[model samples]
Target: MTTLTVGSHRIDLSIPAVMTIVNVTPDSFYAGSRTASTETIAARVREAAAAGTSMLDVGGYSSRPGAEDVSPGEETRRLAAALEVIRREVPELPVSLDTFRAEVAERIIRDYGPCLINDITAGEADPSMFGTAARLGVPYIAMHMRGMPDNMQQLTDYRDITAEVCSYFEEKMQRLQEAGVQQVILDPGFGFAKTVEQNYELLARMHRLTGLGCPLLAGISRKSMIYKVLDTDPADALTGTTALHWECLRQGAAILRVHDTREAVQVVRLWRKFRENS
Candidate 1:
């Protein structure tokens, strides 16, 4: 049973958990998750908590393909404002700060105490991210992405997607350990740099990653891989998301990072029942 230490909390990975996404940016891929104001952010957090989310993942910068660059100061401001609202409204839930900048992660932790650092770039974008996570004693979530959002899509040329991703995590986990990061989580990066076919290929073989010895986070919530395949939009991909959520659980994913909380929690519960009976 793998466990992740998020702040003062220990999340048991033996049973899957849902981490709802709260995007403070105006231009995140999912319109339903875009919460720009304090009122909207708080409402979203409350809704997720009420729906039984195990963790809240708040993001200031949008990592969608070809997304415009957000300045570090603006990202920090957006995240700080959302964190303030989350802390005030839903203080009980553990929060994960989604970012790729080392300075942003450091500043957020320094001001708001500890949080799970979810770096989409896996410390590739910023060299100091691993050290910052270690220094702050926060659990680090490393996602496998080829490059920054603007160029990531063009760099998806893996020889063997599953093996390559597993190898990447092996190297990254070692680096993180050497940097003194005790707790680590791995994200397969559903839509970050992978194509639709590649995403499915990786998902079908995702269980192989569990051998790397860390909790795996699958963030395929209403992403283009689902909506694009179904000839639908993000708003209509909840069914696809739930279907894929079950697949992720079956494939040994420990956490589901999603936009819809209630359905995802239900999927986890059902998956657990199915597993027990199997």
Candidate 2:
């Protein structure tokens, strides 16, 4: 069975893990995820813990398309505050720090302890990220995004979305392995650099990526890929997100990065029951 050793905790991926999003940024694509103050951050963490979230993915820097760049110092400050609250409230829950900067990852780990490094750039944005993750000895989640967030929307021109993404992960896993990084999770970046049509195509063929032998993380929670098709908004995308979550489970997704922990946990439970009977 595939597993991730996060700090002292070994996360079994046989049952899909729900990694709840705890965004500290001012402008994440999903408004419901943004926690601007200490009270809100603590409340969000508590709520997720109560809802049975497998892990908390706290991100300070916003990666939404066209998001303004945040300085590493500011990002670290925001994350430190959020991390402090999480440690105080739910110290035992596994945490994943969503960042691409080696400096940010190093400082956060040094001050707060170990956390899985979830880099949307996958070491492409920061050359030292792989080495940092390796040295810190934390599980790494590498997402496949073509360019920086501000310009990623313009870089979506893949001939075969699924095959190319699979190749990208295969090469990335090899590189991470060579860099001495252990336990890498692959995220195909559902809406990062892909168009709406490309996103659907990638989801349809996501099962192929499981052959890479790394756990897959699906982050399609309340994304435009769902709302755009249904002509709705993120707040109303929960039902659509649940439908996609079921499909992701069917396709062997090991983790679901989500904003709604309760709904995701329920989906995972139902999926587990279905799998047992199947």
Leading candidate by TM-score: 2
**Cα TM-score per model:** 0.98, 0.98
Native-referenced Cα lDDT, model 2: 0.93
Q: Name the runs in model 2 displaced over 4 angstroms.
A: none
Please write out the lDDT profile of model 1 over residues 35-134, one tens digit for every residue.
9987898889999999999999989999887677899999999999998998899888889999989999889888987899999989998999999999
Q: What is the lDDT, from 0 to 100, of the residue 74 in candidate 1?
A: 99
C-alpha lDDT of candidate 1 relative to the true structure: 0.91
Which one is best on lDDT? 2
